[model samples]
Target: MGLIELPAELRLNIYEYFLLRHTRIKGGNQPNNSHLALARVCRTIHIEATPLLHTYISLRTEHQISKFVYHVDASRCNVVTWADVANDGRVMLTPQSSPVSRLFLALRKMTGLKCLRVFDCKSGVRAPDGPRFHGRVILKSEEAMFPDDGAMARSTPIETYKLCVSPTTRSTLFTNIPPTHICTLRLSGDCIFPDASDFSSLRELILDAVTGNHFDRRALDSTFTSSRLETFCYRMGGMGSLELRDSHLESLRTGIGTTIRRLALVGCSRLTGNGLAALFDQLRNLTYLALDMITVRQLQVGFIRVLSPKLELFKFAITNVSYAQPLIAEEVMLCDEIESLIDRDQPPQSMHLKLRDEVLQSSGRWAKWETMVKHRGIDLRTGVWGTEELQ
Candidate 1:
């Protein structure tokens, strides 16, 4: 039998494979010939395959966004579920702009969208004085150009969304978004957003630094504590040490507590070892952990002693790991105070530590760490550690 003469299910599988031929090209006027050929075959095939072609999209410019709506069949947006708008991390700040608003208007038409990411837009004005650097993007209320169709507002199944913005804005862009449809909210800003509690079903939360004078650890805690968040990640930029003490992390136990499975606090420096140990004690089901700043004592307590046996991956991002020698030695050393690292029934499967080439060669610490990681039988992952120039 011919391909189309076969069962309807098998024909659909072929059409799906042909039209959704994987490509990461962000913007273009038309899909490649492979996708076009499938649509041009017959009326029924065109109806079925057109939606599959619009399943994934990445738009960079407002021109691209406008062109997207104009190019694609409005009915084809029925199958579009995942969108990555401007994934490139650049400052897209055009003053007196309405493109972002228009972009939101276009997104409202996609009834089947489940996930969206809008990252690294600069919405801050140039600072008048002091340091000359302003914060990240901040969306205003006027940016809500979404159509007021009650059916469209109530029907979208969009669950996970990420928006990166500045801290000082008086209003937010995603404020009008349907809370019932949103489960994961990734908001990057400097200060604590006052209306975070509005998203009643929010499960996963991410917070990031966007400006100066907004690094209070309590603010990070308050944001995640909005709902029974199952995953929490915080990224701190620019340099400075931070202490995760009672004042900062105490609320975590009562707020998120045993529900959290994945936790990452990256680029922050000098975490108080004991406070982290106490924090570790609460997260008994943690499966993955990533961090940049950690002391030898914290390593001994948190990773060696306190971490759950269910942990599958542990990653350390090295900036200034002068204490790595003791850290490696301590990991290899059998502790009379606690169980041996080798005696674990379900040890982590992978451990990754990314560092500079100079730091790795310093005093043969890298070799020792490799040997220890081998003995522990972990799949070692030192991704692109040798590429960056040493400071």
Candidate 2:
């Protein structure tokens, strides 16, 4: 029988398998060029696989975007669901090849898009020792910028995407972001974040690697705190001393401290022990908490108290944290106590506690806690130093 003689669903499955045979996913997805080649076999096969191939595209330049829209299938441009922009590790913001206007046009064509991921390859592509390069770009707003061509303006919209880009060129696409449809908005790196009031339907927000110099404190006032958010992941960066015990953190407490369900933080070393203690003491509705890379020289065993009655998951990463040896040892003891409490018919029996990082010191207490929580279904993960599988 001929290849087209197979059932439609089975043929589609086989075609997708072959189309993505070259795709790979590590820290992020690697580009695949097989879609271009597979389209050459026949018109029927090409027409069938065009939308499937465009669904998860990793385009990084204007040339690639134009070529994709012109050659692959012009009709499928709006049909794309997930798009990864600035993924080619290009150093220049608007390289000589990919114009920013062209990128804006490419985004305009994606009317049915559900997830859009943006990456600024400046740091990842070029190291500090590389040739010095400097440029800035910003996203501007316009009425007809998003969902252009009168295609599904309010009917179909993007849902959630953790976009990380350096927008300083004053382009007119930032205002086009769907405020009511977006559920998660993650801004990584220092850039002027949009007002929280804009995300009228936002559910979770991640301010990853954002710092103080460019941060707008007024944005996090009533407008931001009033958003219907359940998760907030704030992994801060920079050498500024403005992150600890400030009105910003207090503003969060005063606004939605009792409503946030999951909270994650990478507070700076400047946050004092008192500040750390004051953190968990404010929230009353958290079910999951993750804190990493913090320096708590005086964080005693009692400091890990969960003020939330609904606390279910408490994840702590101690790889880069600067804590005392006794504090680390007591952490193990506390895990043992948690297991004891859970085994004795505690309230959080169905809860999950995950302790991540390479925190196994010479005291040999790591293995003791590791084995104690194995049968109890609690997660006690000791991160490996490098990539050795246990040897």
Candidate closest to the true structure, highest lDDT: 1
lDDT of 2 at 52: 80
Q: lDDT value for candidate 1?
A: 0.55
Q: Estimate each model's TM-score.
A: 0.64, 0.64
Q: Tens digit of lDDT per residue, candidate 2, span 188-295? A: 544444544355667777765554443454535454544666777775545432353445566666664445788776654444434555656777677776665454
Q: Positional deviation of 217 in candidate 1, in angstroms?
A: 8.5
Per-candidate Cα lDDT values, in order, are 0.55, 0.53
| Candidate 1, superposed: residue stretches over 4 Å from native | 1-53, 86-101, 120-142, 145-152, 165-174, 190-192, 212-226, 239-246, 294-303, 318-343, 354-376, 383-391
Error of 2 at 38 (Å): 9.8
Question: Could you tell me which 10 consecutive residues in candidate 2 have the lowest summed lDDT?
Answer: 382-391
- Poorly placed runs, candidate 2 (over 4 Å): 1-53, 87-100, 121-155, 166-174, 193-196, 212-216, 219-225, 237-248, 272-285, 307-312, 319-364, 367-371, 384-391
Q: After superposition, how far is residue 241 of candidate 2 from its true place, in Å?
A: 10
lDDT of 2: 0.53
